[model samples]
Target: MIDFFNNITNSLIFNNFFLVLSGLDNTILLLLISLPIGFILALLFALGRVSKIIILSKVIAGYIFIIRGTPLLVQIYLIYFGLGSVKFIRESFLWYALKEPFWCGVIALTINTVAYGAEIFRGGIQSIEKSQVESGLSLGFTKFLLLRKIILPIAIRKVLPSYGNELILMVKATSLVSLTTYMEMTGIARKIMAKTFAPIEAFIAAGILYLFLNFLMVQFVKYLEWKYNPHLRLNN
Candidate 1:
């Protein structure tokens, strides 16, 4: 057992495996960038889902259906390879962006997250009481004002726990980006393991890094829940 600990430490430190794991900026960046962008688009999709416009709602529903039904790995591959394979795409101005693995990963992650996020947000928005809307209007609130103030706040509080889970899933999903040759945490781990022949130590260190990041995210979500649910906090 002591020898195993020594080997793990040696693999991490002397082999520079720890440095590779610690410097996971791209993985963290993918999560940070994709989360906000995906959520913003999801808010629009959610609004469309609940809106009076039949076409808008149906279109958003179809989008969510297609995205949610498909495998994320396939989605990433299609965006990275399938799109990149098109001659028009290669000739078009968009090629510059599409050719890069990082952008492809981001696009895939964003679209995937948006589908799940839209459903989560829609459920939360629909869960809001009609009386709440009536109350907001009675207080002279405009549609935008109602959404910005009462409706959005309450819906966010309702959906936060679910959203937090999505965020964690996204973090794990980033491991797939390694296939595109973007050296995120998992990619770095694979490379280290390949060179050092220490699969257990290398992968375990990588897992620990993910666990640590998710731990921070969980705490942050708990803080958001407590902060947003003031009535609950007050009652407690």
Candidate 2:
């Protein structure tokens, strides 16, 4: 209706629009900071899972299990309030880092994503043919070299689509940081809605921004997949 359109237009006036955009940038900053760190940790865990050491394997498995089984919001709260509640933590060297809501959210999201990403990567590594490992090992490839030259690259290619989904999930998950009073896109939208008494318009703007971000991310992932899978491109 005309009234709805007018409300949206009015709500998105320059000042309000910029506030919403700032929130989205916060969301993006959270994702950008968390993801690479998470991926590195995940790759290490995945390697541990496939390692021959039973103790190391079990420890990594337990870590993945615990993180994957819990709700992310609960993890966020636990890191933000629960840890911060501890007197010892408050006095520790880590206190400086744990004291901030943004860092707490980053820690939670990174841990959660690492759990999922490790599994995806583990599966991809396992999917590689046994013969390839044999071939690499026979060719004087050290275990480290074999993994770097053979396993990781192939596994990465195999996991790209799944990892892409995980990336998008992390982007959306950043919205939950708002519960900690770290005003990302969703938090800003809520504030605007409260002030203007226009929940629908505020939410719609936030949703569109999220959709746009996810769209660009999805396309980028697809391009990566295509770039890596040359044989598929050749077949096509």
Task: Point out where model 1 deviates above 4 Å.
Answer: 1-17, 234-236
lDDT of 2 at 224: 96
lDDT of 2 by residue, 27-107 (tens): 988999899999999999999998899999999999999999889999999999999999999999989989888999899
- Candidate 1 lDDT at 223 equals 96
lDDT of 1 by residue, 66-169 (tens): 99999899999999999998999999998998999999999999999999999999999999999999999999999899999988898989999999999899
Q: What are the clashing pairs of model 2?
A: none
Error of 2 at 2 (Å): 16
What shift in Å separates residue 125 of candidate 1 from its native position after superposition? 0.4
Best by lDDT: 2
Model 1 Cα RMSD, 1 decimal: 2.6
Runs in model 2 lying further than 4 Å from the true structure: 1-16
Candidate 1: give the clashing pairs. Answer: none
